[model samples]
Target: MAQAKGNALGALGKLTELRQRIFFVIGALVVFRLGSFIPVPGVNPEAMTRLIQGGGGLLNMFNMFSGGSLQRFSVFALGVVPYISASIVVQMMGSVVPSLQALRKEGEAGRRTMTMYTRFGTVGLSAFQAFGIAAALQSQTAAGGAPVVYTPGFGFILASVVGLTAGSMFLMWLGEQITERGIGNGISLLIFAGIVAGLPGAVSNTLGMASNGELSVLRLIMVVGLVLAVTAFVVFMERAQRRITVNYARRSGGQRAYMNQTSHLPLKINMSGVIPPIFASSLLMFPATAVSWFGAGHQSRWLQGLTQAIAPGQPLYEIVYAVLVIVFAFFYTAIVFNSQETADNLKRSGALIPGIRPGRATGEYIDGVMTRLTGVGAIYLVLVCLVPTFMQNYWHVPFYFGGTSLLIIVVVVMDFTAQVQAHLVSHQYESLLKKANLRRN
Candidate 1:
């Protein structure tokens, strides 16, 4: 009876901790969503809406990332894109810049320093983007010819730059807090929340179109089926791994010799996770966004051609996007999973692949395996990202159900669920340890 009571109490303690963390994450997301509604000062909401409705190319994508904040011209209109861009820039720099590379090898303190630099980069990027947005808004007019900005001036530009920058920084801080205290990766969860929050509206829009005879029921069914299929595919690919067998030689003490042990190193099929898609999107969107925002009114013929070529549904856009995804998949996979480091660690532990020598040979073996795996992974990412674009273009399906959004949603949920399970397992282990201690006493 006493043991039963102790176990129950321990379970209850774990439940309390898990509940607190889940609540913190939910609260942070709620705050982010609420902020999405608070419009930037001196902006005409109706004009902004009209612009979004008519600006069906990159603006739609921007609004999706912002959780409709861009359509509302909200303070959080920049969303976390600036921070994501900053992080990618910093990470890429780490590979080429000696100082950054040194910092990467410095452990926790070094990581903190890198993070500080990323935050500063986010601020600068957000401010620049915000000023461009303000200038763009000044040049934009609604269908009825009303200015998107009610009072466009230097004051409005300053206020917008400050508001948008502050909002993005606040989101960055919130993401960090979530990472420290919540269930999953804070930045990923934030982007996940933004994307997922728009689902209901997307559903409503599709259904409404169907009701109005604009969309056939068959098409709707097809769209739903495609989304479900893509989601399952993503889950499978994300969980798939290749296991490499390693053998550790026997270790001898003064008295006894231990037998050799065997283990396997598991390399995930998609070692880069959703990073390739995110990075590709950022790179593709930057130029498109800049052209659309800055050159909207005074676009030259070449500028117009460039924008048209890179628009979301265009062939060139799809091709470039696919190529970028593939390249980033290999690049990011290389950065995050260093074959040399893994081989060195295995060697230090007296472990070696059955048919390969330790050190350079092991590294080469791992690298060769990684190269092949990365190629497969890159193709998978490209297909997953581009398939939805084709569906949207040919079938007129909404972009909300696109492959990129679905990938982010599915991956983030998987990660969040895994984190929760990890916490539960850790809690149960602690309870067992405590009970063992009590019995010993």
Candidate 2:
């Protein structure tokens, strides 16, 4: 840890580009937070907060991911949710749609085309969600009977829809900018920032509960320790990999025949990264949020039952959430690393797995290995996701200290630090090459 800190410090002091990227990320996050505080037209932030808190369950989760923007009824209340939902839709389509699937092989042009599709989808989803939210807020009343939306009319709905959609679109663009000009995965970092933004209040709330005997000190300590332990375990698992040995065919040089070389392809234990949790959280939050709107005014029995059934601590919610995380884990891993494609590339490069044949057999062998790895990965995701539900239900831990938030925070931090170190290493290598060339000259 000390060595890592020292290296980070050295990089910051010596690497201009790394320093700039770090500063850029910090600045972008500041902008995100500032936007979170800016309320949309004709909506009462305090009233919205009261209504949201009363709704509880999924709304809290949504607010947490949005950095409290939802409770504030801010322009960014939607956050990058629409964008994430769009990504989920697009990725699922890419798996099924021949044209979208074909784009994956087109390289940079393919990526650009897919990104355009995602952005277009983001706009559409954002507008739909914003319109629903506007209509819902118009009907909502706080505990004291204050309207969440002060002016409930067509004008207000139009304004809210436009404001929220524009905010979502802006955030999508900002995230892309950060990804290009800054550090880390921009969308992941934005989510990380949202989670971290709520930490101070969560800590204070926990302390207040402890002081009031609402939470036992012993239990509080256990929660803290469990969180720390989970974080450490996640770090270990993220770095863990399965290495498969591959042998390269012998090559003929000018006057020498080089022997075959051996290498190992490292497959990450969690190839899906934080994506599965994020995807699951976003998907699960939607139904609850939608059900909530109907329950607010109508009080229908089925709607109420659904609201409770899918509540955060409920058995149904927990089961579905775990299943989604597990499914997305395997699904996303398959999307990210295609075994047949990898095998084909390897074959073209004259490499073969120890006992597997060069083409279809190699692909099958790799797919088998990946299937096992993904199973383990999916189980890990389920545990990490569900443990917090158990803790929040039984142990009374704050939802802010929940599993999804922690996984995202840990994974994003790991990825960001890894990128920073990689940048420093690249810079050093370039410096070394320059020095060697100068010496030769």
Candidate 3:
């Protein structure tokens, strides 16, 4: 108990040292929030609001993710979506493109280069999306028949394109700064902050619905209960891991012999974390978003079905979402943890899995283990994601607190806490080393 208290005090001291970093993150987030309210020039906020409220589906989900930035048609309306999409493309390319794959293997320098390319790609995506949004605004009409855009022209297009791309760049910079200096992941925290910002509004909206007798109290209770249950489930699944024992053979360096060291490899159940859902959501949003903007009117059966395949609350949508989650879980886990590479590294370091051969056999064994772990991970993700949808149907709830949001919230919190603990541990170790050095001197 005394030791634990000492460690806690040491952690607090280390956190004090990180005050500047914490403040930087807080400042960046405040800037992001402020940007969300600064509506784009010449855009009709009322008309946009009505359009969003009229038909709530994927757009609503996107708006939730953006922290209501899209609803306001803010300069930062596009959010970090473009960058995420660009990352997906880059990841795919890394698998197929030899140069890209080689770059990925080149360590930090290569990663830096890839990040730059992603930023460039984000600009391109932002421009395209901005034009689409601009065109959509120009075409849309208010209830009173006034246009959303004051003047539909090349100037509006250029301004909006620049504004959106610049906004994304700003957000990117904020995220990077946060990651470098903040207590948690800058990007995930940004997204989490955005979603959380919408909570008050969502709650108020729900209460308003209840007052007007549009939503029942029972339904509201069910929604709250379901959210809590889902949050707990996500935490459990996210924390689940497979521990593989490894033994390191120690050798004598002169006349002295050393005992073997042992460790365990922990393979997390949710290996992909929230990444799969983010990708799935972004990819699905693009065409539907384009169609809505284009006023394409959903003519073809195939197009309609395609849109339905990703629409919220639909079985088809849920199924596809689950499948995508599973696929990306395995895909991302493979990318993040290469079994062959791990095996090679372990072998090189004179470490081996207990009762397992040390080379190709070990690699294959590790791969098999990963495959099973990923399978469990995939199911856990799917279950966490699909439960909310089922609850909505069962209880006729109107709230949007589903599996994806819950999973994201839980996983991010866990990871952030772990990172803070790591920082604290490192600080403690440094202090101990310093004390020993002082004693020696």
Which candidate number maximizes TM-score?
1
Backbone clash tally for model 2? 0
Per-model TM values vs. the true structure: 0.93, 0.91, 0.88
Over the stretch 1-441, how does candidate 1's per-residue lDDT look in tens digits?
A: 988897898799889999999999999999999999998899999988988877665677768878899999898899999999899889888877999999999999999999999999999999999998888898888789888988889999999999999999999999999999999999989888888888898788989999999989898898788778888999999999999999988777766677688899999888888788877886777665565556555546576667677878888898999899999999998887889889999999889999898999999999999999999999999999888888888877765666678888888899999999999999889988988888899
Worst 10 residues of 2 by lDDT: 3-12
The 10-residue segment of model 3 with minimum total lDDT is 289-298
Give the candidate order by descending TM-score. 1, 2, 3
Cα error of candidate 1 at position 237, Å: 0.1
lDDT of 3 by residue, 1-441 (tens): 765576578667777877766688788889999999988788878888877665355667767778889888898888887888788788778877889989998999999999988988988998898887787677887567767778788888888988888888888888888898787878888888888887787688879988899888787777787678778777777777799999998986766676788999887777777777766665665556555555546365566567767776777777777888888888888877778888999999999998899999899999999899889888887787777678767656556565667776777788788987787688879778766775699
| Cα error, candidate 1, residue 39 (Å) | 1.5
lDDT, residue 309, model 3: 73
Report how far residue 379 has shifted in candidate 1, in Å.
0.9
Superposed on all Cα atoms, the candidates' RMSDs to the truth, in angstroms, are: 2.1, 4.3, 3.7
User: What lDDT would candidate 2 get against the real structure?
Assistant: 0.85
lDDT of 1: 0.88
Q: Considering only N, C-alpha and C atoms within 3 Å, which residue pairs clash in candidate 2? A: none
